[model samples]
Target: MRVVIALDSFKGSIGAAAACAALAQGWLAERPADEVLLRPMADGGEGTLDAVAAALPEARRMPVTVTGPAGRPVEASWLLLPDGTGVVELASTSGIELLAGELRPWDASTRGFGEAIAAALDGGARRLVLGIGSSASTDGGVGVLSALGLRFFGADGAPIPDGGRGLPEIVRTDAGSLRLPPSGGVTVLTDVRNPLLGPTGAAAVYGPQKGVRDVARAEAGLARVAEEAPQIDPSTPGAGAAGGTGFALLAWGARLVPGADEVAALVGLDASIAEASLVITGEGSFDPQSSAGKVPGFVREAAERAGIPAAIVAGRITGDADVSGFAAALSLSELAGSPAASLADPTRWLRAAGARLAAYRTQDE
Candidate 1:
């Protein structure tokens, strides 16, 4: 039997590629004769670039140095596909992880992300695939827009600083030197659906995660951007992604699409599932939200559509998650005896989880 193992990153613990490899190793250990295929997956998040690179061997990495979330230089790379499509993941450029656990809610900027995009455009990429997830700032994407040649000025007609702290002082924007979108236009990939402002908006919903103690102040910053950019619809779904980076991309004429479904198509996941007798997909935490535009849920649905049995192996399966869709559900936390143990050595537990799933298949047969 052919088994396919595809998983998203286990958040900060392990990346998708490494997780897939470990799972495949354990599966083969349990059934050496069985063919196992490993396909890493991501939903417009930190592991997106790895997923694309793994699926498309023709994708080339174009490395560049850019400003990090903490305003320091960091090495980042974008993927350039053979079809002239540039793939940029915001997590690698301006993500919270870049701060190394030090949150810079009001100071971190997405300017590095925009710089990477600008580099891709200069490389002759005819189109773009932007993944906005795990952002570190709540600046309403002003930093990104500034990097793309859109200037923001205060009422005093002077340029404001970068990050959320400068958001409230913006009075007007000048797009005189702004870069135009590619002929094929831009496609923004995101799993989030929050708007750019208000209670459920970027600041109120995600600012705290980025270390923002003053949610009200952050909301005011985003509100100011909404007030200034009346031409761009702040209420658009996913506008809050990456701290309103989605809204900025929309202003640049990019269309937002569901990251998981689009990535599945890009990586030909359905075709893989069709050829496999069993498919396994997972992530860090399998919760109620997993069914909503996340990798594991998308994989499960795809496998069901293909009439193939699907299994799940997550770091931890939340109590509220519905596991009825999967033939078998395993958690690394259970196998490792504790969440701390599971996180300390994810590779070991993931391997054990794979073996457990293989045993389940054997018993069912």
Candidate 2:
């Protein structure tokens, strides 16, 4: 039997590579002769950089010091692929997890990620892959644009403050000092397809997740930016990704693509699924949200489309998750007794879950 394992990181508990390795070990323990392949997966979120770097061994990690989301100095890293493609993930520097305390929806910035992008450009990278997921800011990516030489001015022509709080004050902007990639173009990878403003857009749909209580303010801020720049299509799909980071990048001439689909293509997931007898995928949480562009959801869908058996191994499987695409599912939290323990040591439980799946067809039956 041939099996392919493609799993996203378990977040704080484990990375994509480690999770795939542990799962493979457990599956091999039960089916020693079965062919198993591991494919790391991400949706432009937390593990995007790690997944990309793991997939490409020749990628170099270039470090740059930049401002963190909370206005602190932090040394962050971006990937420089052997093909002169630079990979930048927003979660590394401006992610929500970096916030130690309360979420600063009004003050968080993507300035750090912007710095990384600038460094990659300075290093002569022509093609850029930007993973704009799991951001901490509701600033509509003004901070990022500012870092790239786009100047925002208020009614008095003064520089706008950082974060969403400054968006409303912006009356004008200019990109006179902007620099373009080496004509290879920039690709913005994201899972979200929400627009830049209104109810289903960036602020209303994602603000609450970032500890924001006033969705109206965030919406207004993004709207203000859109109003200032009529050329930016606020209603475009994916404009809401990364707290309107997609919108900002689009204004700067970046193309938005589905992160999981792009990553899967880059890693040859479609071919792997077709060649495998069983396809397995997973994530930290398999919930309603996972039904979208998340790894487990689309991976299972792809396997089903290819007429292959598909299963999922998630850290926690919510009861309401749409698991119709999967033939079976397993949860580390259930296998390890509790969510706390499962998270504290995901490797052991992930292996156990994998073995359990390996033995699912047998089980002394």
Candidate 3:
């Protein structure tokens, strides 16, 4: 029998690679003869670069220092796939976690992410995969465009400052200096499907979590950009991803793709699942939202199509979580007897969950 453990990062607990390893460790302890395969995975968020890098050892890391979300210089790296495809993760460069205790929802920028993309393009990558989850900005990706050589000039002809605070300044954009990845262009991975400017847009939907008191102000900032740049569709689904970073990339001729699906394809998920007797996948939490471009949903759909059993092991499962498609569902919170206990150490709980699931055989097998 063969088993495949592919899961998204457990967020604060551990990365996708470590989670898979822990699960594999427990499963193999029970059945040593079982050919266990571990595939670290992500849905285009914080661990995207690490996930892809772990899966493809052939990928080379391209490290560079760039401006961070808060206007400070920070070190960052992107991955160059063996096939000349570049993987750029916004969370790595401009994610909310970088700020730690100093949340700057109003002013954090995406400049660092764009710089990493530029580095990959300069290194001869023909196609680009841009991940825009876990942002710390509400600048409608103005700083990203600025880093990529698109200048924003105010009505007085001076360049605006580098954050949402500067967005209200009447502006004109110059994109002539922008260099695109060969003809392959860019595919942006977005975790959300919200529009660029609205009540449920970037600011209103995600600002408070990032520590903002004025969602309306952030929404207005993006609105100004929409007025100035009619070519950029403000109403497109996923335009609100990463505080309008998705909208910015779309304006630059990139296609918006669901992050989980995009990553699964990049990591050759189906090919691995094809030979697996059991498939295990999950994330920090399994809820109604997991059906929306999350790793678990992707795994269940793939496993069902391949006629294999798929199980979910997560930190917690909300009451509304739909698990009808999975063969088995395990929640660390329930196994550990409390949410705090599970959150405290999901890696251990995940191992126990894996061992329990190993007892069940794939229905199709």
How high is the CA lDDT of each candidate model? Answer: 0.91, 0.87, 0.86
Q: What lDDT tens digits, residue by residue, belong to model 2 across residues 1-365?
A: 88999999887789898999899999999989899988899989888888877777878999888899998987789998888888888998888888876699888898888888998999878899999998999888888888888889999989988888888788888878866655799999998899998889988999888877889878888998888668888999999988898998998889999899888876778898888988989999889999788888788888878999889899999999888778788989899999999999898998898899989945644
**Candidate with better lDDT, 2 vs 3:** 2
Local lDDT at 272 for model 3: 96
Model 3 C-alpha RMSD to native: 1.8
**TM-score for each model:** 0.98, 0.95, 0.96
Query: Runs in model 3 with CA error above 4 Å?
Result: 361-365
Clashing pairs in 3: none
RMSD of each: 1.1, 1.8, 1.8
Please report the TM-score between candidate 1 and the true structure: 0.98
| Total clashes in model 3, counting residue pairs 3 or more apart in sequence or in different chains | 0
Give per-residue lDDT, candidate 3, residue 3.
Answer: 87
Residue 355 lDDT, candidate 1, scale 0-100: 83
Top lDDT prediction, candidate number: 1
Q: Ten-residue segment with the worst summed lDDT in candidate 3?
A: 356-365
The model with the greatest TM-score is: 1
Off by over 4 Å in 1: none
Error of 1 at 271 (Å): 1.1
lDDT of 3 by residue, 162-262 (tens): 87887878468777887655578899987789999878888888878888688777777889887866887788999989888888888788899999888
The superposed Cα distance between candidate 1 and the true structure at residue 159, in angstroms, equals 1.2
TM-score winner between 1 and 2, please give it.
Answer: 1
